[model samples]
Target: MSKKFTIPSHSEIQNAKSNRNNPTPAIFQKRKQSEQPNESIIEENVPKQSSEKVMNKTSTFRSFQSDSKPTVPTVTPVSANSSQSPEKAVDKSGTYRSFETVNRPQKPLVSTTTPLLVNSKQRGNPILKHIHNVAWEYSDIVPDYILGQTTCALFLSLRYHQLHPGYIHERLKLLGRTFELRVLLAQVDIKDSSHICQQLANICLLADCTLILAFTPEEAGRYLELYKAFENKPPDLIMEKSEESFEAKLIDTLTSVKKINKTDAITLYSTFGSVKNIFTATEEDLSLCSGIGPLKAKRLHKAFNEPFIKNIKKKAIEEVNSTEVKEKCEKGIGNENDNENEGC
Candidate 1:
């Protein structure tokens, strides 16, 4: 069963190659037709189906994404309003007006039931008799009198001050500067009162106090009574008034004396040309006026050029000032340049 090994001729091989190129060979042509259908089938039908599904899915996704994307907004312009209330509405425009105010602080209330509070030690003093104009209460106080919340007074009689000159210094040192207003009410009682008053003035000046000199105890008591009565009143109540009209001024000036009235004041102005003429007029000339009587004329004439405080012999104060006193020459030193204690 062995076969012989033989090589094909070249002409036979050529003829078979020529057959592969020529589709007229029945078997080869049939094979090529079957193979071409399989390869071309995938290329035409499968690619079309697969590519159409993928294209549809991608196109749908792109459409959905484009629809879901946010669009650009349109901007609108707003105009400013002329008036707006801050209590209700807000101002969003360019212009805004605002105001701020503060509540006025309530004034601090000052409460004082009694007008004056006197020291219990001052119960026997005569100043209490003249204090009838205002109510007063007695309390154990450091100062002799207390007029108001911030005012206090220290009483010193010149008669007593002469007996103990060092007493006031101790009292003042103790009093210090506790009160806003301190008053040193001095009643002049001695012939050497001038010297003592100077010393008191110096002491009061150094101690930050106002010194009031009273010649009589009655005057001093009147001052104390008035101090309490007018504590709350303004200074203009007792100060000299400046009237707007000349008639008002003349009437005020003419009615200043006791027992003179407005009727008499007007009558005198009508009778006399001016105040100069009135001042030059005598009692007889003044009495000739319509309403003024003899007593009033004489009183008015006396009031014209009279001294309020007169006939008091006030001698010059003695050289008791520490600034003016000569230093002591103890040990009798002879050098001119040295102090008196060390020099002659």
Candidate 2:
């Protein structure tokens, strides 16, 4: 038997090739379009060196860039009136601003010891002549004289206080809490000195300042000198003679009598050597003491021996003696009217 042969059209041929996994013309065109990068895609590869490129731009690295390009951040231009503010200079220097550590300058150390401070105004003061024992120099200080680190001195003349009574008060207020031991040296220059001195003493007491009364400027200077000289010494140096001595006690004892003054008592003690001997001495011996006059001596002698009787008994005895004397006179006269007094 003879078989009949048939020819397929081009469209049928393409459909058969496609079913067999053979690449068709449309599929090949799509593959070529994918392999050949788009011009827009290729132009997107702008880099740091567009003019001086290191590699060929037709590199295989640019093949899938259009499909797999990373989402690049869009940059917006800032306007002049934008709310954004420039960084502050302090923010950079302060903490948490930068990774680098911020180092601050350190403070200098203060000393525990300080030099003696004297007011510059006291340069020509005569009291400065006495401040030689301690090392001192001039300074623009507050107090009139800074004796020690915690001690100071303020001078006030009684005359000046009389003129400007509140001057010392102003000065005391100026001291404030600076000095622990404040001294006010007062020179008694006025005639009515005791009353003003007492007022100053009270002022010093309330102001916590020690008051030193001076009659002369030199004496005041000497006090300032002693304070500096004994600044570091123990307080017991002045506490030695706190109690009265034997001579002072004896003098006070002998002066207890109303008539016996201090000089008279001393004279009597020197003459008799003891209290018993002084009382036992005769009136003539008491008179022989230098200050005891004859009247004082006789009165002192009588005081020791006199009886302690009431004035009524002594007056009654004197009245009886006067009556007896009157009766004797009447008897001697022998008068009639005096007969009533005969019984007397």
lDDT of each: 0.76, 0.71
In the range 235-283, model 1's lDDT, one tens digit per residue, is 9876976779999999999899889999999999889979998877999
Task: List runs of model 1 lying over 4 Å from the truth.
Answer: 1-112, 239-344
On a 0 to 1 TM-score scale, where does candidate 2 land against the true structure? 0.37
How many backbone collisions does model 1 have? 2
Q: What lDDT tens digits, residue by residue, belong to model 2 across residues 1-344? A: 99988898999998998878965579888898888866666556555454324246545444333356555444333345765433222332242231123345556686444455678876786666765655677888778777786789887777777778888888788778788998888777778787887888888788878988888767877777777767788888667664367667767766665587778877877888887897788899999878789987987787655666757778999899889868677667666566456543
Model 2 spans > 4 angstroms off: 1-116, 241-344
In candidate 2, position 278 carries an lDDT of 74
RMSD of each: 30.8, 26.7
